[model samples]
Target: MKDENIKKVLLLGSGALKIGEAGEFDYSGSQALKALREEGVKTVLINPNIATVQTSEGVADQIYFLPVQPHFVEEVIKKERPDGILLSFGGQTALNCGVELYRQGILEKYNVKVLGTPVQAIMDTEDRELFVQKLDEINVKTIKSEACENMEQTRKAAAELGYPVIIRAAYALGGLGSGFADNEEELVKLAEKAFSFSPQVLVEKSLKGWKEIEYEVVRDRYDNCITVCNMENFDPLGIHTGESIVIAPSQTLTNSEYHKLRALAIKIIRHIGIVGECNVQYAFDPQSEDYRVIEVNARLSRSSALASKATGYPLAFVAAKLGMGYGLFELKNSVTKTTSAFFEPALDYVVCKIPRWDLSKFRGVDKELGSSMKSVGEVMAIGRNFEEAIQKGLRMIGQGMHGFVENKELEIEDIDSALREPTDKRVFVISKAMHKGYTVDQIHDLTKIDKWFLEKLQHIIDIDEAMKKCNINTLDKELLRTAKVYGFTDFQIARAVGLEDELKSMRKASLVVRSRRKNYGILPVVKQIDTLAAEYPAQTNYLYVTYAGVKSDITFENDKRSIIVLGSGAYRIGSSVEFDWCGVQALNTIRKEGYRS
Candidate 1:
């Protein structure tokens, strides 16, 4: 049941799309508004992003084109008198503004209830010292760190923690003011910058080479908790997750390791009293199986958005319902429309998220990625295997590269240093080193990337090498099928097998390869991403195309007028969520006109 007392809800929006925080909040905030509308609640949305879906008419009862600042929010709260306000749906900008309003007694003065994860819970997770203390209460392992208030305290803390520590600003988003310092001079500089962003800084021992893992977890007010998805960062702990390539359903972890982390994530969220959706990040020593709870985001985060899309679970929608005093068992899964929202989602495919950077658009910017985020946006690709998913993600980033191995080689004087110190081109560098006969072990040692990922990348290279010796006429059906299974696009296969130069047109060569592949009975099949993994029958239209499957999940209605709408794939400099808003609006319009979209 919905909370009848919350007749009017004030929804804060993350204002404008920028680096570190973009598009994901627009997606989450739109879902929240939809959920509120479903519950017959009057929603007042405050967002200055004019091109977002949430700012569109009919999304909310009232739309305020105002910045999500404390003063503006306080003024709106006084005028609107909403019974509840949702802070967790927005990104850090709105969260920080809501916290400021709460600090100034504005919400209390106006008698507005903060919905979803309580303000105290958000503060506990935002403050490094308090987060550690909260986790300590449950005997959870956390990174060894000291919270410092000033430069003097930071220096002393770094000395005590020893050299090569990471400095993180508390209450910052997307690792906003965070970096690694190897010496006193670097520590002083990093700490000063961190102090500018936040009043508190955390100096912690650096787990540079450990695997960075994350879990998207959800909990209800009655203490029912479930882990929706777990992801592994292709880059190790030194790089920020926003800057690294990420894979969902953790490809490298053993069953024991996966379960251990999953259980711990549930424990931490339950202990911290996270009422809705949240994510926990970890740094795991792969060999020792020891781990550190890096941090927990007590809100719908970027990872949450990816997890929701990766699985067929609507995290933001369900989280909004949970915030309105509904139990997990009481709510139905919106995608399936036939199951309870309490169960964990099981995936039958892999998802890879590659970050998109517009570094070249600017002049003289350092391209190296570190603890702080530099990626403006990311693309999530789904496939039947790791190789296919990563390659699709690489292409989806709109970088002019054919899947991993066929890309142009970078001019690196030192391959070892290029791998050791990560840049946006590190993935391409790995492929280059492979071409130069670098062993998987050597690459893994230098890059600190997992051997499983390296081997899969090597497999792609091995296939390309095999194809180099064969022309389109000589390429057998088995070889073509194998390439397709591993995510080689027709264009990539054509280029590899000497068809590109022969035809002088990539489109013609790709069409020839496609025709041959179709004749050989190798074609892409549609697969549904039902949360149940086919254990139970579900009718979710959420689907993806993969070459590994034999049959499509849903039969096509050839008689109906079906219109395909293309979303703006991956937010970049020129395009962002505005095009996504356009696509969604088009789909809605098509549906209203009695057409399938």
Candidate 2:
């Protein structure tokens, strides 16, 4: 009873903002919907969260503000008789629901084909014990670990394994339902909380202080695989990669490590049958430089957005086409009209991403880095040089944006301390460090950023500090001289030195015209990393801190309408919608491109 005429799609979306699930899936799902529409395919989206811009007038042909569950999704499929259902666009909730329906013959009943990866592949990747077994066969190095379902079982596994293990609740994100435990008592308390996220938990040796690295890989049905980009987090092993200041093209990597990861990424994607996009996180122990697999998101993710923006590749759109049986090399490129889909982009510059953290509200949580992600949004800067990239990132997140130092409500001292923490805001702290009396060299050593950039930051800080001590409240001749040397405008120096009146006067003055301050190149610019930036520009002055290599020359000669949605920044408060904002713009752009149901 399978219909050869299957073309319409049913997209499952994760529900609204909640403790466990949030809007990121809506963003990705929205992207897929628009992409399908571009190929003249009808789309039906099922998501309970009506607030998303994706549910608005033109994003999809059929929008059902219904819960994404086995029962409801099956009902829609049976009624609408869509050709396929896409679980990859949705988050874990939708993926899990799709699996449940497939297992129960719900999909078979309607003769619906599941788009993206197959159900068995999803199960093999998710079921920890089975996954580990598969990995063992493949010779992928995993940490010493055990999976347990209950407290007593976990205790038995922990006792046999050892104390001071890492306990992570299954299927949780942002390090939710995850923690470090030293003793049996601590383990019991932590496990109790972790249980809320999933029924099974994984306890493994904590890979603290290791180098955290991520690789975003894309594959197509023809088994054509390519690693889009690699990002290295500033924070060490314990902290989540999203919460760290991440740089692409690995500032410190043995050539072999980089290539090995690239090779391994290809292998894993091919093995898992992931015929679209996936993000793989790893922990490299610095002492031995040994690597261990952290986890993999077998779908479009926040990392995918960052990588897409960083690399200049349209990952989401390409993935949709992959689901349609187009190979990476055969599909039409989206950027460079002359190039074929076969060419994997080669980057000539570095890209850095500084995640934006909203720790200004959470006074109690230690701002120091941790295993879980807590970034609300991230800023991207692009530059040819590391120093320029670093500086650009600082300026992008500062002064004007409420998320950073420009947050007028927060005290300078508090801001200073916030910077001192290993959170994503560390670059701003480094910028402030110049005024705090730390030398450029010392700041570089502390933050692990480049030295050339550190010197410039020190100069900026020195000028501000000098102006503050001089008590030059208004436009002073000496202050201006130093400001020029420190690369600060009169207003910036005045703001630093508490010269509000002088800054106002300087702004009002016609004789001294101050040009726009260029972004300090603190973060990396990806030419091809995030597809969101390619389809559009930032509405507000909010630019992501990415490196110069942040764009990709996509090859598209035909006028095929497509979209790229940004995923929510690793999952933090306040800045969470940064991904959503990108997604919203992508949807708009797709509609503008004449993509319709």
Best by TM-score: 1
lDDT of each: 0.90, 0.66
Q: Tens digits of per-residue lDDT for model 2 on 356-428?
A: 5666676687666656666665667655545445545655654342122232433346544464346544555
What TM-score do all the candidates reach, one by one? 0.98, 0.76
Instruction: Please provide, for model 1 over 190-216, each residue's C-alpha lDDT reduced to its tens digit, 9 standing for 90 to 100.
Output: 998999998889999999999999999
Q: Which stretches of candidate 2 lie over 4 Å from their true place?
A: 1-5, 18-24, 362-369, 395-597
